[model samples]
Target: MTLLDFDSDRLAEFATQVRGDYEELKAKNLKLDLTRGKPSSEQLDVGEALLALPGEGDHKDADGADVRNYGNLKGIRDIRELWADVLGINPEYLVAGDASSLNIMFDLVSWSYAFGNNDSERAWKDEEKVRWICPVPGYDRHFTISEHFGFEMVSVPMLDDGPDLAAIRELVQDPQVKGMWAVPTFGNPTGITFSEEVCRELASMETAAPDFRIVWDNAYAVHTLTDEFPPIHDVVAFAEEAGNPNRFWAMSSTSKITLAGAGVSFFNSSKANLDWYLATAGVRGIGPNKVNQLAHARYFGDAEGVRAVMRKHAGSLAPKFTRVQEIMRERLGEYEVARWTEPEGGYFISLDVIDGTASRVVELAKEAGIALTGAGSSFPLKDDPNNRNIRLAPSLPPVEELEVAMDGVATCVLLAAVEKLGA
Candidate 1:
């Protein structure tokens, strides 16, 4: 039976017993964590060559621009070319920034509140209280940004395929609704990609707020754990075809590809949007570190180089990811009471348990010394309506320990679900 069927007084009674059992079993396991989506230090080693790239002989680019200099506020030209190619947008349409695309995301949101986009009128904050639609079981960080700024976060149901477009469409007419957060490539926590139809719908929005934007963060564009590298549906192109030049802002970084502390970040959009962002950014700083930009240009010689580096990341990360999958398969995949997303790539596996049990399950895991990303973190303001969504980050643990940690996590999931439903 599915997890829902076990929701009953009798099942809840039995589940309490199961938790009691798990509490006893847990004493045997010492400690582990399946939280936080950072590359294992070992997995991060794949980009070591980036530290010493572009020797003295490689300083000058084909455009006669000294990559080492810092005058270009829009990032080194070659850097834009590289990211533009990687992001699938024309070079002229993109304004590549330095590390931290989310910072760029923040700037855009802040700008919308302060200044309008595309020669539009009225500031976002000055307008009616802003509303944002967030796909539940989403990236917590994205939701946090909105909440910290006081944007009313409305939860749009996230399905196995993507966010429910019908729900999004129904609310687009609400004048207070201003934006949505999207991670198209491989969404954090859930790992679901937006369906082509949904992308088309969002791009073709007829909203009361003309300043509506889609914060497109493709953090895992190339870091797939799956064999096939599925391409994300391009919503920007759809928006243009739908005649909304400023519909979405595309972002990415080499934080994963090259190095985290120092990596190139980028943004892509229509010309009008680029001009607005550049104007706003001119006040923030003169330029991002050019040396890092040059290093990326040299480290990733071309588009093919980006892919090659990603393939290496996949090779290193896959083994770690597999350990969690194998453990889930062994412990819960056949039980029918718990289910997890089997992503082709991306750093997370989203787990859903009996409604209202997620937070409790996390507590159980923690009592035994396993740290999980807080329950409801995948939802807006960390509010999972059903409290069933849990994000599993398996990329950090060593392979052998990851196996045990996942087993412990599954035990907690089953225990929590059973307890909640009296299973």
Candidate 2:
């Protein structure tokens, strides 16, 4: 059969059998991992200069602020400008800080519970029970922070259109609901960006709680796996116009940009939110790692620097991502038995196995020396109500190994799908 067999039943069947053979082979091969959305070692090379850091060459900001001091707690000056440009928010609204943006998120929640923002005089902990809406197939760490704080967690459904807005609107009308975890760009696990309508609606929303906030985490703003990634600026501005300009607390970091652990994080919001965060966080420490923040600013002076670095990352990642999709299309595409996301920019592609077979597929992968992120990790408390979604993080594996490993995954999914259908 020709290579471009769009309708070649023979090629299709052959692909299916190849999957079975690979799974059989995997049952005998050495160990491997294709679960975490971590950048490969080769991918890490682009930001190597960041590791050496503020060498003797560079030393100050645009305003003569020293890079080696402890008082720039809000963040380094130029990088604040850089973060503003990078995150598409005003520089005044941004808080340049320590490396982990997620850490900042955790801290914000802690602050809200322990000490309410300036607008609200009461600590959230004094309330009967605070609540948070967690979009399903969401970041586990987001859910953990809520659970850690003893906040009631509500699981909101997510589809291609983003978190079901109708449910979100209704849920937020309750005064007890405090915030929602959002990754508007290239959302983790499911490469879903919110639809423009949903975003605008979220911004225009009148919540039940005056102190409510949107934990707007835009972690994968530039990592596009497909051409479908749209810049959702329309919806992002709702917080400002909705009268509660501080409604969205946005955070991003260069951790995934330059290096995972050592990169700097930017926190953006309205004037009120910034004043609130700074007032509480001001008591805790000096400034963030300005040295690293400045290093990133120097390494990537503008959008061009960020884009150039991302393109290099995409080059290293594309082949691996493409291979996984190709295998899935070849082996599981025809079955009507399983479905997977065709992601545009995020690190993960969520796979939905036959109704009751996800755990089995993961178990099969595990027995053969591959460790899938535990089956339910994409959900809160590692619980996927349907036990159907599996996240594929293709960036971490080499092409050759990924090809073989993905084939095995396809085989497991197919076997599980077919077995259930037969029963």
Candidate 3:
């Protein structure tokens, strides 16, 4: 039975027992971190072959461009084609860059601030006020970018299918609303992909701002942890078909696929958006490290090569994710003080604890030296209005470590819930 149904005497007894367990955990002086969705050392080892890639005298791309030297500002064509095959977009639509897709996203925000996109009345910085819609229980870094630019961040709810489209439709009536962030496939914490209907509706929706842009950060497109995962629909095509071709700026990277810091990053969109982005981005550099790009291209010969790498990643990742779910189910299943996601792909599992107790649970976890992602990291401005969500990052730690940490988490969650009920 859930704590909500527990009689006063039973709840009090449970709370007292949990408090004792918490004390013993604190005395252990343990140290375990689950704060970031970083790849494990074993996962990193899978891509170690990339270090020796594009071996001696192998500096030329397929088009005969000298990768050792500077010139192709947009990126090497062959590499773009490889990524294009993965993203299901044309090679011409892709622009390969250095390792961080987050950096690419920030650059677009900066560019929009200074110059605006082709349709803007003026630079976003010059506007009286700029606002952006942020789907909550989302990637915190995405919210950080909007905050960095001084945009008023509107919090939208994230449903099982995706962000609430009806809410989005209502919010876009404000002309000051300039942009939004989306992690369309296997979203950071929630792990929900947008439905095809929602994608098309967003692509075609009329916005009060002529330059409304969607930063489509599809970071986990190929990361599948289950056999039954569905392929994501083509949002770029959906937008183009709706006659809003320039409304999107899609970004992806091999940061998780190959090496976190050494992999390739890419962006894709309609011709006008690409031209606008390049005209500004080209001034920032001669070209991305083509040597690195060539190394990745050779490392993954084609689309199938990329898929093979992700499978190896899943082999290591699935176990950790499974262990987290198992521990949560065993410890909290009967009490029902918390609920968590069983994501098919992606690096996080989102946990929603009893109302008003998530922060307390994190505080208790930290005292035990088991580091979890801070309470409310999934929301814009780090504010979980209900204060009920906690993001569990199981990828960074080994399974044995993750299991122990999750047990500690279960204790904290149960203790917090009982304490709240007693109050």
Candidate 4:
């Protein structure tokens, strides 16, 4: 029966059984974490060759520039070409950066504040108030960058296909709404990829801020878990066609494909934005870690080589994601107490639990020694207005441990549902 259809007696019986299961889980003293979408140790092993690259006096780049020296402000040309191929952007528009794309993103925001973009009226810090459109249930780190800079974050709804363009079109009418954070492909925690229609509209939309930016964080561009990967529309091509070439900042990294701590990061956009970024970033440092960039270029060898590495990642990761879905289906499918996304490529499964019970479920899971991403973390200020969505990161755990942790999570969901139903 549906949860709402359960009679008082039936609800009471279900609650009692769930309470018993909860106690048993507590007794086991199990410890499992589904907190972060970290690559498994097996996944890390796939990129081991990156460590041995550029070995024994092999320090010159393709153009014979000594990589050990520091002069290529836009990074070495060969590595830039490799990433350009991997990211499907023109080599001239893209620049290689250090390991963390998050750092690159932070730097972009900081630069925008210190010195406005190529077309801005003034530095963002000089504005009376700055606002940024943030899609809901997004990467917390993305929200963190805007929040840290004191941008008034406007939460936008994330539809199954993409962020609500109708709403975004309207929000951009205000000049102070300078930019928005977007993960166009396999978005964090939600796995929603923007469709071609959405991409075209985003590129062509009218915005009051000439410097309006779309921080297109394509973090999982090639991190597919299945053969039928979702098609990612080219934002750069679309934006250029719309005569808004400077409207988007495309970012990506090999953090998941290779070593998370040591992989390369990239930023691609219009020449104006690229020139502006280079002018400011040049003042900060000479160049990024070229030795590491050289190693990555050789490690991947070419675009096809990068695909091979990602395929190996899929082999190890796909099953863990599948197992999580199967358990959730078997245990909670009939209860109708929750719903979740079965993503094709991303590292997360966005779970929306019974309203008003998500916090209780999280509390119960913690008591049973199973850690989950805290409720409402997907929203700005770490507040989910409905208090319903919970991000489930299944990539970190092995299948067996995931099964155990998921069982405890299932029990907590049931117990919380029953309590909320007043059984």
Candidate 5:
């Protein structure tokens, strides 16, 4: 029965049992962590061949450019061609960068603040106030970048198919609303892929700001847990057809596909946006690490090679995800005090406990030596308003440890709900 169905006395009795379970969990002194969506060692091992790539003076790229030296600010054609196919964009519009896509995103915001983008009337810094559309239960890191830029983040509801388009359409009527952030495919925390209709609207929608941009961070573009990959729409092309050629600053990386810190990063956009980025990025450095880019290019010979590796990742990750769901179902399903997403492609499961009880649940888990991503982490400024959303990352832990951690988490969720109800 659901916890709400229980009388005060029965609830109290059940709370006693849950408290006892929590006590046992605490006594175990587990050091399990479900904090971040990091790939497990087993998953990382699948890309171990990357370490030995482009070895023994094998540094010439497709155009015979010496990758050992630096000059191609647009990145090597070899790697760009590989990822362009994966990202569904033209190689000419794609700029291969260093390992971290986050860094590229940061630089884009910083440059936009300092100097205007391709179509900007003026630099963002000149604005009275810059506001950005943030879809929540979203990526905390994306929100972090917005906060770093002093942008007033406006929260929009992230729906099953994508962010609330009706709300986004209304919000963009303000000239102060400069940009929005989107994951588009297998979004962080929520794993919700934007439908083609949503993509088309985002591409075609009218906004008051001429320079309005969307930071399309497709981090989980190919990180699928199933045989079928989600359809990757060419939103850049959509924007072009809609006369908003500079609307999207698309980004993707091999960070999760290969070594987290050593994989290549990519940025795709219109020709004008690419030119603007290169003009500023030229000042940041001569170019990205061509050697590492070459290594990645040699490692994954083509788009299909990348897919083959992802299949191996799915083999390792699917079981852990399944275990998390099973444990949650077994332990907390009947209580009906919490709900979580069943993501098919991404690394995180967005969990919502009873309203106003998420923080308590996290605290209970921590005291039991299981670390969870802080409650409200999926919202802007770390504010959930309801204090109910929790991002559960089941990718980093093995199935055995994940099973234990998830059970403890379920116990904590139940305990927190009972405590809130009792009070």
Candidate 6:
């Protein structure tokens, strides 16, 4: 039965039992972590072949540019063409970079704030007030970037298919609303891919801000937990067709597919936007690590080779995701005190507990020696109005450790829910 059906007496008894469970959990003194969505060691082993790639004397790119020396600020063609095909963008439009796409994202915003983008009438720093649209239960790092820029972050609901387009359309009516953040494919924690209709609307929608941009962080484009990768829509093409050619700054990476810390990153946009990026990027450094880029190209000979690597990732990851869902159902199903997303791809499972109790759940779990992503971390400024959401990262730990940690988490959830209800 659901907790709501319980009388005061039964509720008290249940709370006592859950308290006992919590005590036993604390007694175990377990040190388990579910805080970050890092790839497991086994998953990393899948890409061990990358370590020895591009053997000696393989420094020249397809264009015969010596990769060891610096010159191509736009990145080597070999890696760009490979990931361009994977991300469904033209090779010319894609710029391959170093390990972290997050760094590239930060640079984009930083440059725009200081010098503005190709279409900006004035640098963002000159604006009286800058604002950004952040979809709720989204990536914390994205919110961190927005917050760091001192932009007034406005939260919009992330629906099943995509961010609420109607709200976005309304928000864009204000010229200060410069852009929005989107993880179009297998989004960070939600695992929801934007539908074609949503993509069309976002690309074509009218905005008062002439320089409106979308940070399309497709981080998990191929990090699927299923057999087939989802179709990646060409949002840039949509924007071009809709007369908003500079609307999107799309990005992806090999971070999750291969080595998380040592992988190539990609950026794709209109020619004007790319030129703008290159102009500033040129001053920032001589060029990206082209030798590393060439190594990646050699690692994944073609697009299919990339998919083959992803299939290995799926093989290792799918079971962990499945086990998390199974444990959640087995433990929390009857209580009906929580619900969570069952994602087909992506590294997180978004868990929502009883209203006003998420923080308590996190606290209880911490006391029991389990670490969870902080309560309300999925929202901007570390705030969740209802205090009801928690992001669960099951990717880091092994299946056995994950199962144990999840069980402890389930106990914590029940204890927190009961305490909240009884009080």
Candidate-wise lDDT, in order: 0.80, 0.79, 0.90, 0.89, 0.92, 0.92
Please give, for residues 267-346, the per-residue lDDT of candidate 1 as tens digits: 87877888889887888887777777888888888988888888888887888767777887787775566678888788
Question: What are the runs in model 1 whose C-alpha is more than 4 Å off?
Answer: 1-29, 56-58, 421-423
Error of 5 at 349 (Å): 0.3
lDDT of 4 by residue, 155-269 (tens): 9999988998889989999999999999989999888888888889999998999999999999999889986555656688889999998988999999998999998899988
* Model 2: per-residue Cα lDDT over 72-173, one tens digit each: 768877888876776566687788887799989988889889988655547899988898999989888898898898988899988787898889989998
Given candidate 5, what's the lDDT at residue 48?
Answer: 87
User: What TM-score goes with each of the models?
Assistant: 0.92, 0.91, 0.98, 0.98, 0.99, 0.99
How does model 4 score by TM-score? 0.98
Model 2 residue 158 CA deviation (Å) reads 1.3
Q: Can you tell me which runs of candidate 5 are displaced by over 4 Å? A: none
lDDT of 3 by residue, 1-423 (tens): 787888888878878889999998888788999999899999999999999989999999988988999778789987899989987788888899999999989998899899888889999999999999999889999999998989999989999888999899999999999999999888899988888888899999999999999999999999888654457667788898998888888999999988998889999888888888888877997789999999998999998898988989999999999999998999999888888888899989999999899999999999999998899988888999899999998998888888889999999998888888873
- Where does model 4 exceed 4 Å of error? none
Residue 365 local lDDT, model 2 = 82
The ten-residue window of minimal lDDT in model 4 covers 226-235
**Candidate 5 whole-model C-alpha lDDT, 0 to 1:** 0.92
lDDT for residue 359 in candidate 5, whole number 0-100: 93
Count of clashing pairs, candidate 1: 12
After best superposition, candidate 1 residue 219: deviation in angstroms? Answer: 1.5
lDDT (tens digit, per residue) of candidate 6 on 178-239: 98999988887788899999999999999999999999999998888999999989888899
- Candidate 1 is scored at a TM of 0.92
The deviation in Å at residue 397 for candidate 5 is 1.4
